[model samples]
Target: MPDPTATQALGRFVAGSDWRDIPAALRHEAKRSILNHVGCALGTARDPAVQAALRVMRGLGGAPAATVFGQGARLDPMGAAFVNAVASNLLDYDDTHLDTVIHPAAPVAPPLFALAEQRGLPGAAVLHAFLLGGEVACRIGNAVSPGHYARGWHITSTCGAFGAAAGCAGLLGLSAEQVAHAIGIASSEAAGTVENLPNAAKNVSVGNAARHGILAAMFAAEGYDAAPAAIEGPLGWARAAGDAADVAAITEGLGTRWEIGRNTYKPYPAGIVFHAVIDACLELRARLDAPPEAIAAVTVAGDALLLARGDRAVRNARDSRVSIHHSAALGLLRGRAGVADFEQPAVDDPALAGFRAKVTAALDAALPRGAARVTVRLANGREEETTVLTPRGSEARPLTDAELEAKYHENAALGGCADRAAAQIAAIWGLEEAADLGHLTALLA
Candidate 1:
């Protein structure tokens, strides 16, 4: 028999998946992904970008059917999804699939929650939808990666639409044919570029991914249709955006193996490539005989992708999050690499600014994408160096459930929702058994 088309195969997989068929371990991982996603969104709910999105959404009003997290107001499902997607991704601190560098949860989870709340769906349904959507995004990321990202497509924002559509379609109980149409529709909506990574424009693209996914699924549910090969045909998304899509990448072990299983959460609010740089610098800091201020020079070496993504001038907080020099300084000088370390104030701090100048980056092709080597030369005639291949929060060195909870609490405090953190935590932890999302959505607001 001939192989099925990419979109059709994906549609069928999503439509056919059962919550009971998913292993307990995968479900737990999905819960972790959702938990981390919510914390990241809540962490930046009051951020300038999020505020701007919320204000715009309020002006362009729709039915108040879903919660806009961290704010008291509710908006239509699309509006809520848009605002929440921006908030979760604005910090660049969300979960990552290392191979594709796609922040899967940011674009996928918002729509799932928004639709669940709007439809009064069970939390288990939301969780199941999130898992399938996140998996679809990562798999599509795999199909177009390396070249696609190298060609400047923002993998998360571009592939996220497909995940969003597939997940939302499942929640809507669309048939396989409808799900395929949803995926095909999402192909037209998929957009966002790596060139816009250092500014708020990037967040807008993520917002669009969430909003458009819902739009695609909604349209498909209404009997909208698209060409069957909308994703992999010569004129389709894969070839149109990049060199080509790897059919094997999208279809191999489609449902049995999970890409969400490979997901990694962030410990620092910086690009995942820079985590190893931070880890190495933190280690070198411990071994240095002199104070960080006494250090005359710092060197960071990593793969070409790291230098490509992080070797840049930091003009603001957004730039700082992707700046290798800034990450090195935070670990060496501040001894911590938290959200505050990447804020505008931190960017403008004279001490950090001066220290950033002391740091330099170079390429070592031998090093892995998330790996880094750091060398610090001090004025006291002492030098210290270290290498970190698997930084904290990586799948190999996963954050403990307790550590993840601490992160959630810290994010809640940062978003001024500390008073509600405990209840939010309880709701998320008990999500699978909940009747509906009302309790969780209320706490998010």
Candidate 2:
């Protein structure tokens, strides 16, 4: 059975957390996370998926209470949160917590941004709430870890709802009891399966997480209640979603060890597991003496998780993002794996398609999750190989603040917001000091 007190314990911790209590380092990390999320959302502002979402939200419009990032349109808090969350995650480039593989900011930050913009709240409050929410999400993700995700649940959408609710609850000033109820409500609403990871359907679930999270908090504010042990009851979220919950993972490091600190931003726009494959392939490409056409075969070696997530047939851009073959081809043929490398045109490129057919995946039990070894055989009978245990964007080799800013600039330019990128960056950096988010929201719009 799950721990009976876990839900309430988490609620109490978030309810009582103070901005002053957070370490400076953690506070700065929160800003970094926010920056990355906004940049990702902006980067895809013009994507068809994001455009479709905006149209649907606009059609089902409510009060124009919040600004949609990179668009001039405003939506209700829930609508805005949902749309913004979709944008942040569409590129698969948001911040990741390596342990749980939860893209924390995509589902957590959108609601906080919506609430802050709608209520004219202070930026400090939003950041604090985001920190609390992301911590809750990652911790809950920890409780379910490999099992929850392996059982077909999308960790980001399923656990992300709880984070969104917790942040909204904190922002709404819900008491400990109310916060617990919010978490309970979130358990009933949270859902997203790994089965839909390949297409637009996956993004819808992510949007639902952000929207429903705010709904959970709103209901809690109205004195709505849920069973005290809703999260760990006989048939609770953990057991229902995964084999069992690691209750201690939830209760162990409440405030002392912030999970947000462990969050890492992505340098490549593909699945984190594929970063190692790209890195290894890039290294091999640099040493190759033969031309691209001379390559006979390429082998990618990684743990079972890597193969399970990445070994696939590439039919479109979305498929290429998680395909082992595509990543190898991009690194070996193009020498880079930027956003353009994963697009449909790139996926359909004659040379890249040919190279992809030459690439194959192999099991490597000794290699850890996010590590890869790639070997290439040339027509001349010569071979080149490389292994990357720690990819560029992993926790051990996180992107620096400047690199993150540069990434933001690149994304902003892609989304057609390059002109205002500098001001947006400045606004986000100075977010904690601002009394209100009016300037940021305006700039975002």
Candidate 3:
């Protein structure tokens, strides 16, 4: 029997739906997501990992197929897409869809931007392809959720490949059959490991996915062949990788429901899973008037998953972004975590080390996935406890538009875009009329 879910998803994506077809509120939300992603990419470009990747890409430079955002360098379509994707995710600051547990923008933006530059696509076309790609990535993520991730598969790379294929197919103007084949080819090539967690290599997974997806679409457009039911057939993606396949989730309300709008933006530059604990710690810090010296010890209690299964690289500044313990300690000592929060001095600060050493973390089986309780012990021997159910950047308590813009600007400036990259990206993203993608690329340059 054929896998109907993959067929239905591929069909809806190939139909070329407009962003206007989605609710006005949802469209605004989608715009916010794009802004958040661009902002993070701008900041991420400055990271050593991204710079290293760019240096390597420059060494292997080919025909000028696409423009790399921050470096002002051109590369072949696949090469540009890969490096740009790496830059966007190097800091782990991109927006994430919780249900699917995948960072949608990491894969979607690279291919869309690269193809737009290569083909001179308009802003409206770019936005449309972006939203469609996000939808595909999220649905595929939902189809394999928790299970695929549990099996040591990185969803950003595995599920992201399909998302990249969808985005590229839309940009390339492929037919439904061709798009399906692109997805099929993507499924076969999709791969990323969870073992690289919290390392720069984790970011590379998104880049690889974007590049592979673009290549798959380009090949399919040139009459390449792949399994039609690669997602749902025997030995398909769902069967081979997914834990509990939610076929209905992938197809239900396909055209009317917009999963892209459902994505949540991160206010802090850390893993989404640690947000709840960070919120709890920050709240505790704000409530106490005493200086850091006043605090004797801090204990954070949360779901066992965070303490045990959380990424281990977070013990140092480079790995701390994915470490629940590190984020919790940083939130209590510094009030927030950002790109600057992970610097060597900040990570090695005696004050932070003192707080970090005083902090004890444990898993609470009773706590929910996003719930966290933090207890602070003052020098006076008084303990204050607070429990947080949702983080500030979560859907339950999202960041305001102003906050999102500010974050974008901060990040963009860090990527050496002091001269209007943020404003230019926002202007192009909001344009109703068809504007050349060059305007946006120029801002990056």
Candidate 4:
């Protein structure tokens, strides 16, 4: 169990770079990711869950260090990061990286926004830090591969710890050595379990990752000590999580190969893995005009992994995300799935129950990750079938820029900032000239 050479190389690379050194493509991707995060955050701003968390945060009020997006209240960096990160993930609509299966924005954006406000930093700097963080998270995710996620650990919390540290380290202007220490410190603090799937606690994992990362960076900046080989050490992250660690993937194109380009946006509000099935169901619904009662049975065949890897025993809405039966049922009954699809009334609706009872899912041992085959049996003894090779909004069939913007606006409106957030976000993109992050922060308020 010697140190992993590849993980060590990645640490060195992460520890060495400055924001100015990131490439142009990476920068552009970073901006898009930022926009995506802001949109999702605004969408969840007014959610009861987010509001409840905000109220608790407000009561524990500390120094006014940074602003909470859409809430307009300032909190200490750690608290602000926690609340904002939770809000971004409240609706499960944040951007994700396929390689690591990590929700990139959930952990990256909160720290960047909080630090920007604390340091009076401009939008450009915040955006750069975000890109760097996403790159680090995705690379680490790739290094670990399907192993990390399959091990019952949530990627957004595990790989994301390092991402949060990188963003905070960049903003704090820590030296490479200090950044390395921060990475090491953050590694030890990482903890999340997939067992929390579809729970309000699921979103808490993301917020905790962001908050802990900030703490790790702050500690390193103040002369904290951590094992230099934390990532690559015999018992480090790779050995513990990755099936067969690929360190080269971690450091191969540092500062050049942007992981941000590989990031995917969610078109539907369910798990990324279930998007194709939902798409297939929606397409079938469009072609057939019948109510849920007219359906005899609905069958979905896709990556067996969905049925195999997913937790089928759903007790609540959050649990519904990982349940193929639940997602497919919602798709057939309502012709769509969203945050509202998993609500109590929706989940308990008699029509939805009838549809759910008719829905049968099996893993297509042959289908690929982004593909699915769905069959609907009509009460009239007629049957329809459709196969989706790739869901919309995936890199295989990306959403148009206009579609992306529309998604942002739609989510922003949900978070209670639909009217002005988009325009303000545009201004923030030109943040190199802005004096403070207040103008943008106020939009969330």
Candidate 5:
């Protein structure tokens, strides 16, 4: 017999896992990821993109089984999953696994939360499901690596379907065989292209992954069947979705060391890869004695991937969040970068645009993926440079618990629901003790 397949292993983990069996550290990380995901989702639940998507989903008229986060609307579990996933990721501020650049929580948590509420599940169970999902996401993400991402596939939504499916499967108490079927079913539906990254549809891709993954697990729980080798078999997910595969990455030490431990948060709303440039530029800005106009030219050097992904002009809020010029400009000229910095009026500022024009980004093959150097040339012939070897939100320099709580409030305020933040945070921290998710859902809604 061929060795166990990826689908089989993942299914076994999802069904066989016991919350008490997992380590305390892993459980804690799961809570952190959950808090971060909820904060991010609540923050952007009112965005135009999210609102528009919600409008469409609500118009479809499904059963009102779950809350739609800050929107205060109830929809079917699938609709809730779709809308919450979009909101979680619409800001591009969700948790990321550096090895795969996958926003691990956005696609998984929405489905998990929706199902937990639908089933009146306790927070402890929800946490367990979330951990299982995130682990599957990062491991599969590792299996595909740069090959899956470079080929124009958005790994978050692609691999994330598996995570969402596993999470929901765990919640539904599916058996190992049925959970494997869920993964197989999800593989057939997983898809998201980088070509969609520049618009609202990028968020839609993640939303689809969340919604569809839930549907897959729900179907599997009802006796749906799929190929046992759907993930690692020839002509399977690994070969079809990526140029190459690292089978060992998926199965080696699968359950021993937790991959979710490495999940990192973003301090800024922009892309994670651009964070080093933002850090360096902010440091240079702090040292400047001159006005915003003093800078003659700015130069940014970083890894080839950074330049390729971030070297673009800012024309709108969505573009601003991913642009190297916008990050360099806002950091140096304003001495700050935040969600507001990437929004309208701020993005339309003439002074920032002037600085935007002067910034040039180049690729350095030797620099690490998350490291950057920024050099500023002043009009009076003075040039200063700063290099950031470790960005603030990377695993090397993570945000503390207090900082994460502050971030949650900041996001809640941005979402116009700051008054609800304290209660939500309290409930999240005390999740395991709650009787069910109803109180939490009401607070979020």
Candidate 6:
């Protein structure tokens, strides 16, 4: 292969990793991320944002090559991957690699699925590629890290394009050099911004990442070459987009320490950082006897990361889903932050806003990323406090298979497909044994 830059190493792994030799825990984590992403995609497939996007895409239709999950229309492979990715991320309920805050599966799995379905690939291949892609994405993400993220780059899209392309390249059984070219080609188009998170644009970024990956691999398959040092060269992706790269994070321990093994799913639809706040508020709610009106204030103390992403005013459901205020309000008033709790009706509800105004988030340098302390002060002169060191779904407190299955059902129901959810769940759990991709395609609709 070309010079041993970061992308080439990642490409080699993507193209050459043996599925049979992958550790069981890493494989399970891959399945967990897959199950989480599939549920998220199904739930939001018919959402307004997706509907609008579908309309535009259908108007500019290409070959009917691949199915858009939860929709009848089959779009071109790229278009299908893009729409499926958007649907997966629309709810912001997918899994997250907390170290980089990148939702790995959203971008990687969509292209893998789209390409696999079009090629009639088996579930095992899709599953293996998905995991491999996630590893590549997260490692690249780890290299640029807080610097890339703090600089307003949406690491999921920026780093994910590489992962998506790498995975798709592997799924297509491309050579290591071809995989390297795919990674390099994707580097040229990597982008997304933190400013778009509260709007449909965020999903567009994710979708674009998925589409760009497929296109990158397609171009590479045709012998197109990217700059050899596309990812780590002085003027390449890392230097251009991020302040610095931790080379060690990207190059150390290839298959031994899998990044996907550290993935965490969201129990709430909101940003993962606010999950601890949700946990805290729900715990405080349990200790209260008075009505919502009796609560004078709710204070949430967490890492500075919480304030960076979660502390925001919620004018609509889009804003509400990423707002700590809504998370707190839902937990205190409704005792849960389900998918429906972040709906338009909830955003417009006066009581929700009133409850929101009482909640405040304070930056605490001492607390870990997933930990938070919530205190509620009541008009009755009572106070209750709860600290969640490990919110549910964190690797430290992973959701049980039963809990994850419940999550799948809840999400699948949102797309009005509860009737098919059970079967879909069964298929995903038994994905390795599946004979073909037909069952997955059918479930999407």
Runs of candidate 2 exceeding 4 Å displacement = 1-4
Candidate 1, residue 4: Cα displacement in angstroms equals: 0.7
TM-score of each: 0.98, 0.98, 0.93, 0.92, 0.97, 0.97
Question: Between which residue pairs do clashes occur in model 6?
Answer: 70-444
**Ranking 1 against 4 by TM-score, winner:** 1
Instruction: Give the candidate order by descending lDDT.
Output: 2, 1, 5, 6, 3, 4
Better-scoring candidate (lDDT), 1 or 5: 1
- Report the CA-based lDDT of candidate 4 relative to the real structure: 0.77
- Tell me, what's the RMSD of every candidate? 1.0, 1.6, 2.2, 2.6, 1.3, 1.6
- Between candidates 2 and 4, which one is better according to lDDT? 2
Model 2 C-alpha lDDT per residue in residues 139-178, reported as the tens digit of each score: 9999888988888999999999999999999998899999
How many residue-pair clashes does candidate 6 contain?
1
Q: Is candidate 4 or candidate 6 better by lDDT?
A: 6
Candidate whose lDDT is highest: 2
Cα shift from native, residue 16, model 6 (Å): 2.0
Taking all chains together, the TM-score of candidate 5 against the true structure is 0.97
User: Model 6: per-residue lDDT, tens digit, 1-445?
Assistant: 3447787788777877998999877777777778888899889867888888787777776877788877777888888888888988888799999888889988999888888888889888988999888888999999998888888999999888988998988989999899999999999989999998887788889989999989999999999998867888889999999765677798799888888888888899988888988888887777787787899998888887888888888888889877888898999898888888999999998889888999988988999987889889999778888899989888898887888889999888888778898888888887787777888788766
State each model's CA lDDT, in order. 0.91, 0.92, 0.77, 0.77, 0.88, 0.86
Ranking by TM-score: 1, 2, 5, 6, 3, 4
lDDT of 3 by residue, 16-70 (tens): 5655676777656767777887778778777787778877777776777788877
lDDT of predicted model 3: 0.77
Clashing pairs in 5: none
Tens-place lDDT per residue, model 4, 387-436, is: 98878878788766677788887877776677885676676565655677
* Tens digit of per-residue lDDT, candidate 5, span 335-369: 89988889989889998888899999988788888
Q: Which stretches of candidate 1 lie over 4 Å from their true place?
A: none
